[model samples]
Every structure is written in structure tokens, then in C-alpha cells.
Target: MKKWKRSARLVDMTRQLLDQPHRLISLSAFADRYQAAKSSISEDLAIIHETFREEGTGLLETVSGAAGGVRYLPIANRENATKLSRQLCAQLENPDRILPGGYLYLSDLLGDDRLVREIGRIWATVFSGRGADVVVTVETKGIPLAYATASHLGLPVAIVRRDSRITEGSVVTINTVSGSSKRLGSLSLARRSFPEGARVLIVDDFMKAGGTVQGMIDLMGEFRAEVIGIGIMAESQVDERLVENTVSLATVTDVDVKNRKIAVELGNLFTQGGFFDGTNPD
Candidate 1:
């Protein structure tokens, strides 16, 4: 590749970093790609790093040594996370979101790519240091959230199915009770989806009583996999929670169907002190 101007190089470098999050790009590789000296590549990275910090885009961690390089971690600061959470809460407060079964309508929100990406960034931030090998989520509604999170973490997504599928090959199925209805249900995961004892980060669209999340945890145990972290988009108030230590972006404090009123608030992720500190409760 021909040598490019600093301005052009900066643009290209930023684009590359943004395109591949959580990937380590050696300075030597960048130098060779742009046909520039290591010193020049380092200078370019410094500028990009400062800009990322100022804009709260995320952190660019530089590793030194022979195998050293730079890794991008997609994280949202507390202020930005709180702002996004509040906006989502306000949107969710709409009475039209109330479904017949006392469930909140979140399909529209999940369908929005931009919103899902932002939420994914938040989830990535919360579990950045978990050393998660894969992101897992149950089939259907949570698949998008799981994939979005996986994109930022640079990890593969392992989807659990509600029923066994022939295409998935050998599977492991587990029985669990539905939190909302208390009905017995089964979830299955393909045996080839992940290796044994893999560290997994679990993500879900919503949590009423954590029954589904608990089921996923149980399923992970079958493979001897570690549940490094769990993230929930929204969790509703429940008298008894089947799971604990979950990080949630928003909380549904109250849902009054007859009065058409819904109370939503920033979740424990905001109130919890260790979220921005990189200390996961899980």
C-alpha cells in the first residue's frame, strides 16, 4: 500500500479500530499496512486514543512488548449509559407497550439496529473483563441482543433453542419453569455450539423473575461451562427472584394496566458503584 497523508491515515485507522472491536492490532501490522514507520503509527494511534477518550466512544488499550498491540474495548461512560437508560425507560413507559399478558412490548425496540447496538455496547462494558469465550441467549427475542453483544466483544454467539432441532445435531435439553406463568418449559442447546468448560456471558431481553436466566445457568452447568456474567435489558419488580447478581439497564418498578401507567427507572447497573470500575458482581 502507498503511504498516505496523516489525515487520511487517521481516518482509515479510526475506521479499522471501530470495525473490529476487542481485536488486538499490532503496531507493526499497522506500520506494514500503511508502509509507515512504527513511530508514525504510534503517533497516529495516540491521536485516535485521545479523541476516543474525549468523545467517550470507548477505550483503546495498548499492550507493550514483542507481541504488543492495541485492543479496542467498546464501553459507555456512566453518564452516557444513564442517559441512554433513561431514554429507553421513557419510551417503555408508554401504555401502548402493555401487552395482554402483562408483558411489556419490546419487539419494536429490539428491532431497531441502532438501539440494539447501543444496548450491546453497555452489556460489553459491564462484562469486559470476564474473559468470556462466547455470548449465549435463548432463541427468539433475545437472539438479537446476544448477537449485538457478541459483535462488540468479538465473540461468537451460542443460541439456545426452546425445542430441539435436527439441524443442531446432538443437543442438551433442560426443564425450567416460566417465571411469569409458572409453566414447565424446556430449553435446548446444540452440543457443538461451544466447547466444554467454556466461559460464557449470558444476555437476555427482559427478566421478570429470572426463571429463564436460571434455566440458562442450569443448562451451562450440564456442559461444565462457567457463567461469567449475565446482563438483562430490563427487569421487572418481583417478590421473589430466581436469580441474583444480574446487571440490568432498566427496571420496571410498576405496571398499572387499568390506569395505563408504567413506572420505569434506571436499573442496578447505574446505582451499583462497581459497574464503571470494571468490577463485575457476577
Candidate 2:
């Protein structure tokens, strides 16, 4: 690497940290890259950490000892999370999003890169300390949300398909009943996509009675994987859920198809732990 000014070094360092997410970079690596002293690198890290905290973006976690350094932990403070929840609530309340079966359209919002990324940050933040080895989701719509969360958590994603495809190679299959309609369906996962006895974090686009989520959990058991956490973008209000112990961003309360109305509110984001202090949001 060529010699760089402190300003240039800081910018590059920040980029490297963001790009790598949970991968730790030794202080010496940064120091050698910019031909700066170890002390100088430490100072730069402090400055970056302060900025990250103030913006409610993430945190720079430092490790001590000769083999230790720092890694970026993607997280959203309470203030940032509240803003995102409100935005989601407003967008979801649109009556035009209602479909024939009273289902709300989510493709547009999920396609919004900015919104999806922010939601992923929250998922990653909320599930950070759970020690999940991989992010798992059923195919189709849940793929993007799984990848988004995986990116922030620095883990690989395993996709589950509604049907086994030759393209998926050897696979394990499971049969499940739809919690909403009581319809029967099958889900399959590539045998090699996930390792046996791995810790899993399940992510999904939406949930009604959690039949799909339950199916995934049952599948995980087949692989001997322990599911550590579950994150859902939204969940429909139901009298009884097939699954529980989930963190959802929003709840779809009422969808009056006749009146073309939708009611949505923020879901259990704050009740869980690891969020920044709410007294004085950043």
C-alpha cells in the first residue's frame, strides 16, 4: 500500500471495517497498511467508534492481547430502530397493498435496498450474542431477508425450497401443514447447504400462524441443528400461533378487504435486549 494522509487513512479504514463486518482486523494490519504507528491506529479507531455510536450505526469492538484487534458489529440504536419501525408501519398501512386473499403486498418494500438493509441490521443486532452459525430461510421471498441478516452477522445463508429440485443436489425433505389454510406442502434443504449440529438463526418475510417457521425448526432438528433465534419482518394477528419465541418488526392487526384498509403497528423490537439507551437516543 502507498503512503496515505491521516484523513485518507481514516476513510479507508472505515470502509474496510464496514466491508468486513464481523471479521477482525489486527491493529498491526491497519498500521502497516497506512505506514502509521500502532498508537496512531488506535487513535483512529477511537475516532471511528465515537462517530459510529453517535450515528447509531454500529460499534467497533476491540479485543486485547497480541492476537487480538477489532471487529465491526452491525447494530441499530433505539432511535434509529424507532424511525425504521415507523416507516414500515406507514408503508404497510397503504390500502392498495391489499390483495385478493386479504394478503398485503411486500415485494416493493422488500425490494427497497435501504429499508431491507436497515431491517437486517436490526435483526443482526437483536440476534448478535446468540451464537448462531448460519441464517436459514424458506425459499422465494424470505431469501433476501435471510441474506441481508447474514451479511450483517457475517454468517452463511441456507435456503429451503418448497420442493426438492435436482439443482439442489441431495436434500432432506419435510412435510408441513399451512397454519393459515391447513393446506399441505413440502420443504427441502440441500444436504450440504447446512452442517449437522450447527446453530441456526431463522429469518422470514412474514408469518401468520408460524406454520412455515415451525416447519423450518423441524427441518433443523433433522440436521441436528439448534435454532437460536427467529426474526420475522411481519406477523399477522392470530388467535393461536403454531410457533412462538420470535422477534417481529411489525404486526398486521386488521385487513378489511371490503373497505380496502390495513392496520399495522410496531412489533416486539424494544422488549428484547441489546438496544441502545432510549432516554437519550442518538
Candidate 3:
């Protein structure tokens, strides 16, 4: 058998593992495939894991106890992440989609099954093994994307409400400041909405001043669930406060009605890596 350099072989292995991170394969299997010593294979896995962490793609976890094996997480390589996000944002450039009050109409994009599924897949990839157990969102518009993301993660969707529906029976309600508003409004959660300690991914259609995001954050606390991450369809870049560890498909600066143009910029989520360059291996 021809011997391959450890660096080259490790890169190749990383690609295969990332393509299916949730699937586990034995160390012996990897060693046999590479025709390398078990020790060498283990070392290669370590190097790949370390590099992946450094790149913020995801984790390489070794399962212990019976039925244990090495697994790659479906985390995004920075470049792929950026490119995916940029593609979503670019769709906003259509002048026809612009609406009154500086809003960009995006129901058409969100309603597209393929685009929603792709967006969901990207979110799932980012939070793949970070232990997010449920996806949560407020009512109406955010439901489709939230359900799409939940489906990819194989998790349940928890709904927070702007107003409680009597059909849900008794509910828990909490009052807090909405994004950018000094006045407090109530956000409600249904009884048994989620099990305690379930990690949550918050999704929404748009984030303007973050009031809605904050409402969801507060709601999560009431359920004793932790927010693993937040994802948004798009963000109004003009309002910076709405974002913090939040990923958006695009950031809009100005929706120019008079000029028949919308000034959009790539959000920081894409710029940190991936979208700008193809440096990520997977």
C-alpha cells in the first residue's frame, strides 16, 4: 500500500467526517482505512479536532461507554457559512421586494421550501452538537423557519406568544421590556412548553431593535431552558442592539424607496470567516 503523508490523510479524513458528523465510525475502522497505525490515526484525529475548534466549525466528540466511537459534528466551516449567508442576503437586493417603512418584503423567500430548508440546514450545522434540544420562536411569520430548523435537528418546536390563545388552556405569562421599548408587554408561554434544562435555539423573521428577541430570551428563562443560540432571517443593520451571538442571513442598512435601491451589507456572522474566503477545509 502506498503511504500518504499524515497531514494530507488527515485533511481528507476531516472532510469525510464533516460530511456526516452525526454518524460515528470506529477508530479501528479509520486506522484500517488509512492503513496507518492506531496511534497515528488517533493523533490525526486529535490534530483535526484541534484545528476544527480553532476554526469554530464544531467539535469532534469521542463517545464513551458501550457503543462508543468517534463522531464529527455538523458544524459549518467558516467559508461555507459565509457563502450560505451571503446568498440569502443577496436575495434581498430585489427592488420589487422593498415595502413601506424601510422594510424588505421577504415572505416569498421564507415561503420557498428549498430556501427555508437550506437555511435550516445551515443553522443546524452551526449548532449541530452543541446540545440544542428544541427550536423556539414567536408566532406567525417565524413559524416556518423555526419548524424547518427543528426538523433538521430532530427536535421539537416551542412557541412563544404575543397573545395567549384560550385553546391552549392555562398558560404562563411574563412581562418584560420589548426591544428598544421602555414600556413592558407580556409574552406568554403555554404550559409544559418545554422540559426544564432543554437547550433552545431561538429563531425569528427579523430583528429590528431586539425587543422581540429579548422577549423570547425572557420567555426561555421562565421555562428554565437555556438559549443555545439565536438565528434571524434578516437584521436591520441600522439597529445594532438586536444582535449578539445572533446569526442573520443579511443585514440591511437602508431600504431606499426613492432611489429604488436597498443598501445591504454582509452581517458580521458571515464576515468572521467562510463567506469571504475558501480557507475552511469543510
Candidate 4:
């Protein structure tokens, strides 16, 4: 590759490393892939690391001991975070996103590792100073995204169950309203899973009426754990206020199934224009 192309490729590699920090890769791997000498690879990394330091981003540390490798710690400024949030919200707002029960489906986006990692990183940064002890969510579908958030925060996750299973052992069940139906339903948590006084962040796939979220709060009360934060992948605007300390990546409203038209709004996660570039990327 030409010199300019090589540098651009190096920057791309650096970004990839930042996205998956704590996972190490050898210099020889990059050198071989780029068809460059080890020294050239080292020079590229030096420039990347200097950019990171100048920007106050975390280090791209090179371990010198046995089993040494490079790892990138992504420290995105507020601008980067906001940009991502706005982009995600706009994508969710597409009129064709309608699902059953007026829900805006986002399973496809959640399954995209790159996008989900960005969302998780933004959440991790927002809650970095909150001293959260764990990330919690009710499961089946939310597990993957919740896991992403938990991975970003270096925290463990506890799952709430809509239906109790014998495999979970003894449990503490709570009665609360279901998110889909207004009627009350029972949810269960495995007893002793969380110790007393745990600070938790609640996460989920979608939040319609937030009945399931309230059920989690009730369960948290039983264990005396505090709900420090809540996040959902996508939320219907009709029920945004049902939970507090919540962040939604996208918002949808005005679903007319017969007309096959739905309205979506990019959520307020980046509304303050605090972290984003202050304009739509498109």
C-alpha cells in the first residue's frame, strides 16, 4: 500500500482495537496483514498512540513481558458519543420499523456487534461516574445487548425471568405489570443472586409500558439493591415516562398499521448535542 493508504489502514486498525479493548493482538499479525515490515507497523502504531495521547484518549499499551501484545482503550470524547446516539436514533425512526403491538423492532441492529458496541460504550461512559455495581435485565431477547453493556462496564449481569424455571433454584418472585399488556404478571429472580446494597443498572430490549421494568424494581427492593440506571435498546414514545433513570437509543410513535407508516424520532440520549457532532451525519 502507498504511504497514505498505509497510515489510513493503521488508523482503522487502531479504531478496531479501541472497539475491542482487553483483547490483545500481536504486532506480527498486523505486519503480515498489511504486507509491511515489523518496523513499519511499529511506526504506524506510534503515530496512532500519539494521536490517542494528544486527544486524551486512553493508551494503546504494548506489553513487554512474555505474552506481550497491543490493546486499545477507547476513550471517546462527548462529541463521539453524541454522534453515535443521534445516528442510532435516526435509524430507528424509519417508518417501516413497525412490529406487533406498535413496537419498533431493533433485533437486527442489536445483533450488529459494531453498532451495539458503540451503544454500550456510550452507556458505559455516561454511567462511568455513577459507581454502578451490576447491570440487570429481564431475559430471553435482551441478554445479548445487556451483555454488551455489562462488558463495557466490566460488570456482571443478573437476568429477570418472565417464567420461572426449576433450573434457577430457589427464587424470589414479584408481581408487577407486564410491559406489553396493562394487566399484572409475575416475574421471578433467583434468590441470593445479588447481595444486599448492590447498585444496579437495569437494561432491556424494549420498554413499552415498562411493567416489566417496574417488576424489576420491586425485585430489587427485596434484595435492597439500588437501581442506579436503566437503558433500553428502543422505546415507544407512548410509554417513555413509565421508568426513571432510563436511556433509550431510539423512539417510535404514531403507528398506523393499515397505512403501513410509522414515525420514529432519534432519542434524546444525544439531544443536548453534548457528545455528538451537532448535526445529522447524512
lDDT of 2 at 278: 49
The TM-score between candidate 3 and the true structure equals: 0.70
lDDT tens digits by residue: candidate 2, 1-282: 587999999999999999988988999988889999999999999999999988989999999999999999998888888889888989999998999999889999989888989989999888998899999999888888999999999999999999999999999999999999999999999999977999999999999999999999999999999999999998899998999888888889999999998999788665445243244434
Model 1, global lDDT: 0.90
Q: Give the candidate order by descending TM-score.
A: 1, 2, 3, 4
In TM-score terms, candidate 4 sits at 0.70
Ranking by lDDT: 2, 1, 3, 4
Q: Give all candidates' CA lDDT scores.
A: 0.90, 0.90, 0.77, 0.73
Candidate 3 has which clashing residue pairs, if any?
A: 21-72, 78-274, 79-274, 82-275, 179-211
Give one digit per residue, the lDDT tens place, for model 1 in 115-202: 9999999999879988999999998889999999999999999999999999999999999999878989999999999999999999
Error of 4 at 225 (Å): 0.4
What's the lDDT for candidate 4? 0.73
In candidate 1, stretches whose alpha carbon ends up further than 4 angstroms from where it belongs are 274-282
- In model 4, state the lDDT of residue 37: 85
Instruction: Write one digit per residue (lDDT tens) for candidate 3, span 204-268.
Output: 88887887788788778878889999988788864448446787767888778989897677765
Instruction: Please report how far candidate 1 places residue 11 from its true position, in Å.
Output: 1.1
Q: What residue runs in model 4 are displaced by over 4 Å at the alpha carbon?
A: 1-50, 53-76, 272-282
